[model samples]
Target: MEPPGNATAADKADAVETRHRAVLRKFIVRARRVEEHSLAADKERLLAWARGTVTLKFEPQSGNSTMTWDLPEEESLDSLAARCRPFLLQGDPVYHGKVTNALGFFLRLAPDELRNYLREIRESWRPLDPGDRETIGYESRTGSISQALGDLVTDKELAYAWLYGDLVHADDNGEERLHGHDIDARFQAGALLITNVAVKAISTLNLARAAQSQNYLTLEDSVFTERVVARPKREVRVEKFATAPVGTPPAEIEAALDGVVPRPDSSKD
Candidate 1:
């Protein structure tokens, strides 16, 4: 990656500057993707599900009698984890590590400049119109971007613990770290913290866009395209099952099955 031996000092300087700009551009791209993923995630809905605000109802398919069961805490956590997996999982494009690393690069490139830019952007959003008093309250219900980033940095260990131990893979070390903790509380904290991280990512789009305007960076307009897509609607229904005596034949159970679709038979192929 070194410049040619005959290259002049000006050439070397230009090359290095180009490389640094490339880093900023890369960070901008990743930050944009994080925002896109966050939008699709629907932060409020995920938070509600993670916080157990939504009642989870399910019917057993194999039980001898028809009944509805409330989803257990473990299952609820699993559902929440699935929604969170794309944003926090290690290999995911929008993983917290990737987002943080990009922001770290921006910091490394120009520490004071980046801090100043963030402050300026946040303050710019501070002023509100006199007629907007109803919506603009004493403070934001969700913390500011700077606050979110600060919390994410301070609580990094907990973030990873939640990711590795509960939300994604069950690493032994992660589980050990989670030992002696209230499972639900830790999970709730982790989910909210993750949401904050997403907020940080989304907020930084504002910063990056502002930076581009100031000539601190550059980005394409297409990077900010609307990415959220509507999901197709589907119908949900409960299946009925009846109690049977012991030693019931498989044929009888198969005959009694209702609303059960048989899987494709692959053996013929």
Candidate 2:
């Protein structure tokens, strides 16, 4: 959970250049294998990409649908929190309250923020006069809520840290060396992502509410109007084999693929 050096200022005072160096070091280590090339240029190139930011964009779509995309460096915390408040309020009293507080705790928001937010929504609530038939079943509510949670935790990649509950670092060494404040710092960064997830969840909840406001539809019957879609992409940058190509095998093929340096027979068995 170490903080990103410079692109983001929310979590730490760590210099961006310094953080970039560390990230590059790790990136270089991973990118080193399966290729024989100088990394100075690649280091600079990838560092530039790492130094970039992540942003969230929202657009209105047809038929009550809203679309959201996370751009390179522009997420709106205000928009995120606005989305969370309404969605959390839709939940049943006990569990929903706890989830709200959990978000408050992790995101480091004011203690009463969740409570106050829910209260405000309630105060603002007015039952539709077209009403008596406007009701959604528990099964419909749960199903829709579950679907919304899935969207936040997966596909969108917004609540990754929260969903997985761990530090996500890619290393050839397969070791997580972060300790102490580094963990909290990264958690802070993740909290920012969580804010976006909360908003998306709220959007789904609104869709369900829309269906509920109508005569015959239950939550499950609600048309899904809001969606967060990530463009599918696949890139094959390198290809390396543990076994040498065809019949001309290199002696170091196994070692290179295993990433193991040869061990001398220093200790006799």
- lDDT of all the models against the reference? 0.49, 0.32
Candidate 1's displacement at residue 62, Å, is 42
For model 1, what is the C-alpha lDDT against the true structure?
0.49
Candidate 1 Cα outliers beyond 4 Å, as residue runs: 4-6, 37-115, 119-156, 173-177, 226-269
**Residue range 1-269, candidate 1, lDDT tens digits:** 66999999999977766655555455456555555553325656643432334344455775444323222255544443454455444566544445444444444555576767565534432221112222221211223455531221112344445556666778652434433334443554455444444455556666667556655555565554544333567576857665679997666667668545455569877
Count of residue pairs whose backbone atoms collide, per candidate: 0, 10
Model 2: per-residue Cα lDDT over 1-269, one tens digit each: 46755545755534533443333222222222201122112434323322223344444553354433222221332233222332233342312333333332322333364335544433322211112133111101112433432111111122232223443333221113221223233333334443333323342233224323542122223123322322367577666666556874464666787788666567977
> In angstroms, how far off is 26's CA in candidate 2?
25
TM-score of model 1 vs. true structure: 0.43
Ten contiguous residues with the weakest lDDT in model 1:
131-140
RMSD (Å) of each candidate, 1 decimal? 19.0, 23.5
Error of 1 at 230 (Å): 11
In lDDT terms, which candidate is top?
Answer: 1
The alpha-carbon deviation from the true structure for residue 51 of candidate 2, after best TM-score superposition, in angstroms, is 43
